[model samples]
Target chain A: MTRTSAIFRRELSGYFTTPLAYVFIVIFLVLAGVLAFFVGNFFDRGQADLQSFFVFHPWLYLVLIPALSMRLWAEERKSGTIELFLTLPIRLSEAVIGKFLAAWCFAGIALLLTFPFWITVNVLGDPDNGMILAGYLASWLMAGAVLAIGAAVSAGTKNQVIAFVVTAALVFVLAVAGTPTVLGLLQGWAPSSVIRAVAGASLFGHFTAITRGVVDLRDLVYFLSIMVAFLAANAIIIDLKKAD
Target chain B: MLEIRNLVKKFGPLTAVDDVSFSVPEGEVLGFLGPNGAGKSTTMKMITGFLAPTSGTAVICGHDIEAEPLAAKRRIGYLPEGAPAYPDMTAAEFLDFIAHIRGFHGIEARRRIAYIAELIHVGDVLHQPIETLSKGYRRRVGVAQALLHDPAVLILDEPTDGLDPNQKYEMRGIIRDLSPHKAIVISTHLLEEVEAVCSRAIIIAHGRVLADGTPAELAARSRYHNAVRLDLASDEAAGIAAELQKLPGVASVEAAADSGQATLWVFPQGGQPISDAIVRLARTQGWPVTGLYVERGHLDDVFRTITAPDATGNALRDAA
Candidate 1:
């Protein structure tokens, strides 16, 4: 465990030592802020809630989370640093978990930086801080799920571009799979149960439940399960893929 | 101390290492000699517990690599080939990370980092990113990282691969200094490197141990042991060659003429001493012999003769 923490510190330091962490925070804040004001119509909606802001999270994470995670394992493998990590006395699982946690924490920090919006809502109107907290929790969990998937894809190949593309595509499908916009277009072609199942699997549905202060255990379980499943797959792929 | 018993590694149908076994007594230096692709790196990897072998076992300082990898790894320092490292991190940061994982804390880690930097002569570039350092410095950092934990068994794969002559000499001196209390195995294709640093040499060709003995012992086994070289004056060259070739036990002789001087490379058969026969034959013919010396066959010849027949010889040799 101490070794894992050591690795975590170094991994986080790696993120910050480069321009990556700052670039990510700036881009994430700018994009989230712009969408909240414009497409989300926070002012026009005239609601005390941050429903306008939380609503765009599923779509925002589909692209951005993959970009954040595409370099995790793929870059390590490409640069031959995986050999150094694997040769250490630490267990493979420990290293994987440590690195995953570092990426998650970095993503979470970016998410936390958005709290000024929460403070702004509270200052201007009587917003439900409890619901806003729930929304933040749900959105963070969704990001974790996306990160896991992206990491797994990144482990499958040495090319970060390919990992990013595949992760974006996977997250996009998961986000829109349960949405009415897509179901309405294919309403007559597919059964309602199939549509509902697909829509229910969407990240939006799970996060929406949490945003409404409805902390369904099933939604939480689904997100946790996806994160574990992808990470497990990532480990398996890294073990199987021989270095060139 | 390290012991490997019949260690074998296979990748599907390709056997990278086979039935390789040897033991390194504490404080002994062993040279791992093989051609490119000869399982030197694979054997090192298995010893470090980076790869599991298909058969046999590697016991590092009494700990089995497979069963107790952490314990075994903790006692063994491995310098992998090509010196792989995180490009984004400075040498100091990489060393610090390694020190942290090796259980060095705070002030102790700082002291150890400084010690390693000075030892490997990378102190000047500690703050430079590893990618920005020159190849020689990068390799030094790799060696520094391997030695940071001060393990008992040091497995250095091509430790002097990219070093300049001066750096190579310095590295050789360091290896010699470290050999008194630590067991060291140096894997390299350069025969002179083995001659310079290793007390004993293990030659592997085609994934199998071809020869194992002291450098002098192996050199003495060459078929050219009885051969001699003689330099002759131009007027006496033809007479010497003709006479030497006809002498009893003299099977084949090669003579070359250059710049008014003649040189003869003589091969005497039947285990006969070339000098004894040549002295007798030269005196009889009254040929002036400017120089006469026994010509010891080079280690390179022995290596090429043993490893060239099977290119696969380069891929499956193991050193304990």
Candidate 2:
């Protein structure tokens, strides 16, 4: 556990040690705000709730989270620091979790910086703060899942750009799995059970369910399971690819 | 103590490290010598648990590397090839991170960082990011990181690779001072390093152990062992060469072209001392011997002889 925290502390401070952290946060904040106010019609929606704000999160994270997680393992391998890191007296799982948590926490910090949108909705009218809180939690959880997938993909290659592109493509499919466009295409030829299963597995579906004010146990489990599954794969990928 | 037994590592169809094995007792410095791509780095990586071997095992402080990697790794302080470290971190922060990971914290960790920084002379660059530091400083920082934990076993791969002469001397002094308490395995292609610091030497070639013994012992295996060279002012170059070759116990003699003097090298038949006999002969012939010295043999000659592809038949077994 101490070793895990040691790695965690290094990775967390690693973000702030460079301008990459500030640049990523600024881009995330600007894009999320712009997409919500200008494109999602947050002010024009007039709904006192942050549905318009939360609606753009999956799309925002589709690009931002990969950028955030691209260096989790890829940079280490590229720089040859993975040799030093793995030779330490720490388990592979601890290092993987520590780095994943650091990236996830960085994403969480970016999400928290969107507090102004929450304040904007609250000051304008009576809004159900419970649903807003749920929206934030769901968004952070979804970001964790995306970052986990990105971390796994990052371990697959030493090139961060490749990690980013592969993760973005994978996350995009997960994000649109439950949308009408995808379901419609599958409806004509696929079985109903297959369609239902695909929708249930979508990140968008689980996140949207929480934003609707009632957090289902299944949705919470789904997000946690995704994080765990991908993080585990991240550890395995690092072990297998470490020699390369 | 560290024991590597029959360690083998194969990367697909290529064997990077063949069944190489050796043991380092406490307070011994074993110099791992080999040519480029000769598996010195690969062997160290497997022992340090950075790479899994295709077969065999390394035991550190009685802990198996593969079965109990954490325990084995805890006993080792490894400086990987190229001395890689997090470039974004400052020297102080990097050492602090290493100390923390090694289970040191607070005042103890701070003291350790300070001690190692001073020991390796990296105090000047403590606050500078590793990337901005010079190559020598970066290498020192890597050394400090490895020594911060002060593990029982020290595996340094080319510790003085990028350092200047002064820094290399200091690094060697530090390693010499620390050798009495730790089992150190330093890998280098530098033959002089083996003589300067290592108490024992292992010569590897083609992913196999070509020879292992003390520096003097390996040097003794050269054909030039106990040979003598003489430079005389006399103009009888061929006559002296013929006389030296005819002398008993003298295997062969070669004379250099005359440049106002004759230079001759007399090789011994069985590692015998021929310098005294040559001195007697020079006195009897009234030839003025301007220069004379017996050769202890050269490690470079032995290294080339054993590592050369066609010289496999002449590879000497370990003298130990």
Report the C-alpha displacement of residue B239, candidate 1, in angstroms: 2.9
Per residue, candidate 2 scores C-alpha lDDT tens digits across B44-103 of 999999889999999999999999999999999999988999999998999999998899
Model 1 misplaced regions, further than 4 Å: A180-200, B257-260, B270-273, B276-288, B310-320
Worst 10 residues of 2 chain B by lDDT: B311-320
Candidate with maximal lDDT: 2
Cα shift from native, residue A25, model 1 (Å): 1.6
| Tens-digit per-residue lDDT, B1-320, candidate 1 | 89988999888898889889999987889999988888888888888887778899999889999899899989988888888888889999999999989999899999999998988899999999999998889989999999999989999989999999999999999999999999899999999998899999998856778888888766655556678888887667666677778888888888877788888888878536768878877787677788888856567766776677654333322212
Clash total of candidate 1:
11
Worst 10 residues of 2 chain A by lDDT: A235-244
Q: How does candidate 2 score on lDDT?
A: 0.91
| Residues forming the 10-long window of minimal summed lDDT in candidate 1 chain A | A235-244
- Candidate 1 lDDT at B217 equals 64
Local error of candidate 2 at residue B90 (angstroms): 0.9
